[model samples]
Target: MAQVLEFKLPDLGEGLTEAEIVRWLVAVGDVVAVDQPVVEVETAKAMVEVPCPYGGVVTARYGEEGTELPVGAPLLTVAVGGTGGPGPAPAVEQGAGAAAEPTGTAASAESAVSSEYSGNVLVGYGTAGPAARRRRVRQTAPAATPAPVAAPAPAPAPTRQGPVPVISPLVRKLARDGGLDLRRVRGSGPEGLILRADVELALATARDHREPAPAPVAPAPSVAPAGERVPLRGVRGAVADKLSRSRTEIPDATCWVDADATELMAARAAMNAAGGPKISLLALLARICVHALARFPELNSTVDTAAREIVRLPDVHLGFAAQTPRGLVVPVVKDAGRRTAESLTEEFGRLTEAARQSALTPADLTGGTFTLNNYGVFGVDGSTPIINHPEAAMLGVGRIIPKPWVHRGELAARQVVQLSLTFDHRVCDGGTAGGFLRYVADCVEQPAVLLRTV
Candidate 1:
């Protein structure tokens, strides 16, 4: 009378329809306790750990790593009674609008109930089974008599799950280019699987190993005039889609201003020299944006195009555009308004590093109320960056250049940088946009404005 229970995939938030399995914490034959982490899942917005709803021995794994499973799919099967002993069958409870069928053994009824409740695995919900039983130890034989018995050797350690598999063609090509062995890597994909990063890591690890150099071979003839061709997919594809949607959906207005950031640059240098990682002008600018959003909450808002309304967020979450080999990604710093300058700088470093390594989760990319793109890093003067929808505004920082300016009626060369602000004209007027840019420029020029505002 062993009781079997099926654990289905849980629904992650934000209306996620599917998830890729990043890893499985337990395997068949392993006994797991209720509320123990059983798997890691990657939804469109974040990577989250899922706990077992019921405690028991895992009997079967339903989904393989790297498989993109829709919500409500079965993930694993667990058997609930002690090993080698039959347990009482499970009871089935019928809900409203259902007809009763012929009664059967509790086991059969339990199976039917599990199948019926297969869909709708929401987070924090319990699994479809009876409560877990407490563990018990077997009694040992009496010590009294006989010949001493030799102890058996311990069993070998079980193999860990391998890299998640990559199903996308673009991901596969990238993995191949990195010379990765997919079988050895575990995916952080929808199902317990391998993804592109797993392959990249494998290649990186392989490169670290030293070996005798291979003999030189003649170069093969060119198949076609050799020119680099990068596929517009994954991050690149996402960027294209986001930008296009922002342009088409948001009524954008661009405003430009010149900021004299001499004091701000000095403060940044001092902060970096005082036991902090090197802080860039871009970072200081981001800090100013955070402060500005606090003073003017409306700037930190989004437009619900479908709902035909403007939604103003209560807190500021800043998104910084980071360029990776895959494409442009905007990893966000949540609750930017609550962070100190030093903490913000640290977070910026962490997010940038994670993005470069392709290890950022969905949570790092969403919930941004405003965005900043540093075109200055590329030596550009200034250009309007498209808003990251449904956010209503974005800021672009340009290169600092020595330009002629009048100081006390005398002309002199001074360091100046151009700032571009793009806002949703539907929600923000040109006057509001200009005021916001001016406030930012004033802060950059003085640097003390931030101290006052903070």
Candidate 2:
């Protein structure tokens, strides 16, 4: 007898609850091996492939591309131990909700449920690793058949049964808000799972779409050209929420000072000339920030308002701001206080590349004690930036442009930069904040000042 098993979306970790379907790797009636990637999903953090736990012919899939499913939602069902597919499937040893992941043997998947690589594919649906690619087994598409003119069969009516087959709260909320009965809409997802799209489809068919009818307007002369509008979602939405919370909860103050970075630039040139790995200018600035934080540790701490106490972090998880196609992101470097300038430079390079390619993991994007925003990349001179919430402070660097300065009583062209510090006023006074910013400026003007503490 053919046994079917349902696999729900597993925890992708880092407190993520839902993911949007990006692409499907296998189709219905396709033979999928255990731990093989079936769909690519985009979480708020990153894009990952959700591997199937069951090895058998794919019976059904739940969501379409761009449909978001919550964690523990059924992704698909597999007909295990069925004779209809290409090869023999492993016997169903586990009951429903047990591991549907890869069994070891390809020859007898119906019998084998254990594998050496099982650790990589955690319980329900973990991340897929680089496994040996098995030959793709797929049913031919019906579109290729001749005379494809028949109307599609009518969808079966949804049953009010023991389980609703609905998983996402967002989906349920939509149906409730729209006053649509969940039992009326036919689910298009695998195994009759109701999806947001299914509810939406029902709404459009039965009731008004809630979109207002266009208002009558007389044609008018065109004025100035309009600008573009980008939807705030994904990374952009996360940024907006965090910054808004910071503004609402935090009493932050900004202090800025101009620094002569000519010596800092010269020191960087010297280091690169004799270097094994060229040190980045940002790394040097980061090194200065780390050392300054050591002296004014108050700026490196956050206020726990509930407890009414300041929590001072022991080590610095340094976050540097990098702009990507997705918008601005801050990738944190762990234990930055213990790293050398060379190491910091290498880490910055790796994280920056990952950000540009949109390959940063959730771990790479969080847990920062402080942030270094080199807004100078955008060719700006200064900015009063909102702090990354819960973190005590942020350091913003402006463009290092050449300007006339007095060097040893002589006016000379020198590289100068403006540094701004935004700190939570609840944690520290103006004196402590000014001391931290002044120390950073001193390091830029005299690179040797950093060596005295080192």
Candidate 3:
């Protein structure tokens, strides 16, 4: 006898309750080895390849790809034991299969499968306690209709959309942001799992094949059309939720100061000039931030509203905002206060690359004590950006450009930048916040000032 066992989705940790099926790695009648990845799914945080712990032949899949299922929903059913045919399709004996089929109102077929699973717990979730026997729910006899009805019961309406198979979350996000239907894109990966390259190629091909709107044949009174709708989901949704929380919960204030960055930029150029492994500009700024935080530790702390206490953090887990094709993400550099400029530069490089590839793990995104946002890359002078919630403060750096300023007791064109500090008013008053921003500005004006604490 062959036992048909059902496998449910496991808790993927990090408090995620559900995941969207990204791709199916196995199909019906396929032979699966224990611990082999059966499906790839996308949660709110990252894309994960989920491995099946049961070794068997797949009998049926519960949900289609792109289906959002709860943590405990049935993922697939497998038929194990009993070998008959050479391949997986004929694994079950013909006699067992015939006896199990539900023919009429009389015969019922079933068997219990053992609960023991391979000790492979991917995504940090595993079955607990002793294995238990599982039995199929019995179906009641169909009630007789008033007339001579012979057809089977009608199916209910579908609430969700059909499935689309794709492996990369980045690909899905791209299609979502561009308002493109993922089902229309062709997959190029194994078993037709869509890759990032496939999406990009499809987009390029679409653009190349598209023609102008015929200029309306004749410009008919150009009228304003309705705006396009964009649903906030995935990375963009996460950002929106956090920003809304920060705005609603925290009483935050912003303070800005213009700093002379000539000395700092010159010092950076000099370091690179004589260097083996040159330090990055962001690294130099980060080093200054650590020294500034050391002097004013209040800004490095977070407010424990529940405990009604201000929790001052000891180690600075620095987070830098990196913009990727998916969206803006902040990858943390752990124990940044203890790292040198060279080390910080190396870590920043590694994390930025991971962010670009959308390969950042959950650990890389959390545990950020402070955020350093260099919005200057967008060529902006300054912005009063919202603070990253739970974290008490964020330092925003603007573009450093040549501007006329009073230097050396005379008017001169100096490379200057605007630095803004947004802090939770509950954590610190204007005095502490202003002092921290002033120290940072002083470091920019005189790079030598940092040597005292460096």
Candidate 4:
């Protein structure tokens, strides 16, 4: 007899409370081994492959693709001590398959899987305690009845007055922001689970059916045309939230300078010509930023709001912006101040490739003490960058192009670039910020200035 064991979604680290099912790797009726990846999920931080800890036959799955499930929700169930051999699970069609019939009691399932479980789910998270046995609740559909056309009631009906069956905190926030009561809106998901779609539909229906005000005495105003609507979720939503918080919390100021980068470009060309590994322009810029921070340490610090003190970081964990198919992401290079330009180039290349492939982890994307934004790739001249929250400063690099400039007291065409520095006013005064930017501008104009620091 096989003991049917349930596997709930494990907690992914970095305070992620939920994840959306991106794809299902193992379907129902397939046998799997311990610590094998069974599904791919996308959280706000990154894409993760979740592995099943218990080895057995995958008897059932819970969520469909694109469904957002909260932490601790049932992911799937496996039958341990089954008849199937443990070589490997044969690949099944990648779709949500119907669950297999229950084979054993919950108590039996819990006892059988405890010994075989590996207790590892993600890189930083593990199961500290034994898995709790959950009794599956099956909701039976009520008899069909004719309902209003505008608001068709969902099956199992709405809970008139009880605890709302909501999963995602995002859905709860959505309802709260819209001033809608969850007790009135019906749910369409399993066990009458309240989904974000349900809340959106209920809000739309209410707008369409609201009572019209009394006709104006003179004339009526023309309605504005409806534009396309895009939901703020996933990576986009995370970026929006971070930017909003930065704007609301940080008192930031921007100062910029136009510098002649002709000598810096010439120095890079020389270095790459005689190098074993090709050096990138971004790496040189990062090196300059690192040295500049050493001179003005205040820009490398973060403010402790509760403590009302400046926390200056000893290391320079540098973050550089990279645009990918998913959106804009900043991957950090750990302990960047200790690394040489060659090492920085290699690390930047590795992280950029990972960002492009959507393979970056939360650990790789966080712990950045300072950010370097190169909007020059977009063919822009300058931009006032917003400081990444909690971090004290950011350096924005614009396009380096040929412009007429004084070359040793003579008008000539030179490779020129714009550098902008955005810093938190609360962390340092204008004089400190100005000194840091001036040092960077000097290094950019005269690459030999960095050699002294090196």
> What's the TM-score of each model vs. the native?
0.55, 0.73, 0.66, 0.75
lDDT of 4 by residue, 1-454 (tens): 6665667666675667788887766666566777666777788887766777677876557767877777655688777774466433323222222223233454344344333222222452221111210121222322112111224444334457878988678789999998888998776553556667778888776665676766669776878768997666677678888889899989999999999999999999999899599999999999999999999999999999899999999999999989998788888999999999999999999999878776777778889999999999999999999888779999999999999998889999999999999999998899999999999999999999987987
Q: Which stretches of candidate 4 lie over 4 Å from their true place?
A: 29-31, 80-121, 124-227
Residues 1-454, model 3: lDDT tens digits: 7666656666666666567776666776666766566776766665556667667666656557766665644566666567443254433222212112222221111111112212222332211111210221212322211111112213321332467765445677878876667777655432344555556666655665575555447667858777997656666677888889999989999999999999999999999999589899999999989889999899899988889999999999999999988678888999999999999999999989877755666678889989999999999999997888889999999999999999889999999999999999998899999999999999999999988985
Ranking of models by lDDT: 4, 2, 3, 1
Best candidate according to TM-score: 4
Worst 10 residues of 2 by lDDT: 142-151
> Cα lDDT for residue 154, model 1?
35
> lDDT (CA) for every model shown?
0.66, 0.75, 0.71, 0.77
**Pairs that collide, model 4:** none
Local accuracy of candidate 1 as per-residue lDDT tens digits, 168-205: 45456767777654555544433434444445555555
Q: Indicate whether candidate 2 or candidate 4 has the larger lDDT.
A: 4
In terms of TM-score, how similar is model 3 to the real structure?
Answer: 0.66
User: Candidate 2 residues 1-454, lDDT tens each?
Assistant: 7666666676666666678787777876678777787887767665556666677776556667766677666677677774455543333332222224423442244223223213322233323332322344455422111111122225435557666777667778989998887876666444556666677777765554356776899988889678996555667767888889999999999999998999999999999999599999999999999999999999888888899999999999999888887678899999999999999999999989878765677778878999999999899999998899889999999999999988899999999899999999999999999999999999999999998888
Off by over 4 Å in 3: 1-5, 24-33, 55-59, 77-231
Clash pairs, candidate 3, are none
Candidate 3 backbone overlaps, count: 0
Q: Which 10 residues in a row give candidate 4 its minimum summed lDDT?
A: 125-134
The CA lDDT at 107 in model 1 is 35
